[model samples]
Target: MAILKQYKKSDGTTAWFYKLYMGKDPITGKERRTTRRGFKTKKEACLDLARLQLEIESKGLNNNSVRTYRELYNLWMSQHTLNIRNTTEQRVRNYFTNQILPSF
Candidate 1:
């Protein structure tokens, strides 16, 4: 289930509201809040809430795990440069050693 709430905006000219759902983090198993936008009209609010409800029902609400920099870089290299020739490999290695590794 999700939390439905409403409030007045800072300017007091408009009303803001939102629907918040609790989801567990996939990697950590920690509870996290997912909120949909607030709108002036009740229809708009309901529409946002319905969209979120659909997403939660279909996808389940776990955040995907993050990949470390090294992991990402290696994956990128494999996809982008692993097919290159030996000369290109040498150039890439030189660039990694002189530019990328030092900076990172």
Candidate 2:
């Protein structure tokens, strides 16, 4: 479910926002909700809310898929090495390959 409302901005202008019920946390068993604000008009807020609802319906809440340790390490390394020097990247890779990957 979603609730849409209008509010007065600091400049005395009206804006729209929506509070959406996004189901519960699978692990924690607690409710989840999301609020989007600062829309210029109610139509804009409703459009975004519809899009979000459609996305949740199509993809469902828990989107993660199981991955092996090696796959996870490779994915992490790809991002972790992007801004680091080549030597630092190699050192991190070596630590994972020799010490971490072996244990896992």
Candidate 3:
């Protein structure tokens, strides 16, 4: 399906909003539904939707409380490791442990 659906933004600009059905909310005990909107094109809207889906599946986008920076750093460290040297990795780890972890 073509991802772009057009809608009017609050600023009166033409925009595309993607509508996806997210499953029900667990805590509020209410049926949950939301829309990701205000993109300028269908491609943008679809890409946004895909990102939202990924974040939701990854437990990074909690509806109740925002994720702490430490949690995000750990998540990033788990998923991404490129050609960086061991020293770089250690430095990153140390930074996270000392700076980010203590704040949250």
Native-vs-model 2 lDDT? Answer: 0.91
State the RMSD for candidate 2. 3.1
Deviation in Å, model 3, residue 69 alpha carbon:
19
Model 1 clashes, total count = 0
RMSD of every candidate to native, in Å, equals 8.4, 3.1, 8.2
Candidate ranking under TM-score, highest first, comes to: 2, 1, 3
Indicate which candidate wins on TM-score: 2
Candidate 3 per-residue C-alpha lDDT over 10-29 given as tens digits, one digit per residue, 9 for 90 to 100: 77889888666666667655
Residue pairs with clashing backbones, model 2: none
Name model 1 segments beyond 4 Å from true.
63-98, 101-104
TM-score of each: 0.53, 0.67, 0.47
Which residue pairs show collisions in model 3?
A: 4-42
lDDT of all predictions, in order shown? 0.70, 0.91, 0.71
Model 3 TM? 0.47
lDDT of 1 at 4: 56
Tens digits of per-residue lDDT for model 2 on 16-65? 99999999878778998999999998899999999999998898877766
Backbone atom clashes (below 3 Å) for every candidate? 0, 0, 1
Which lDDT value does model 2 have at 80? 86
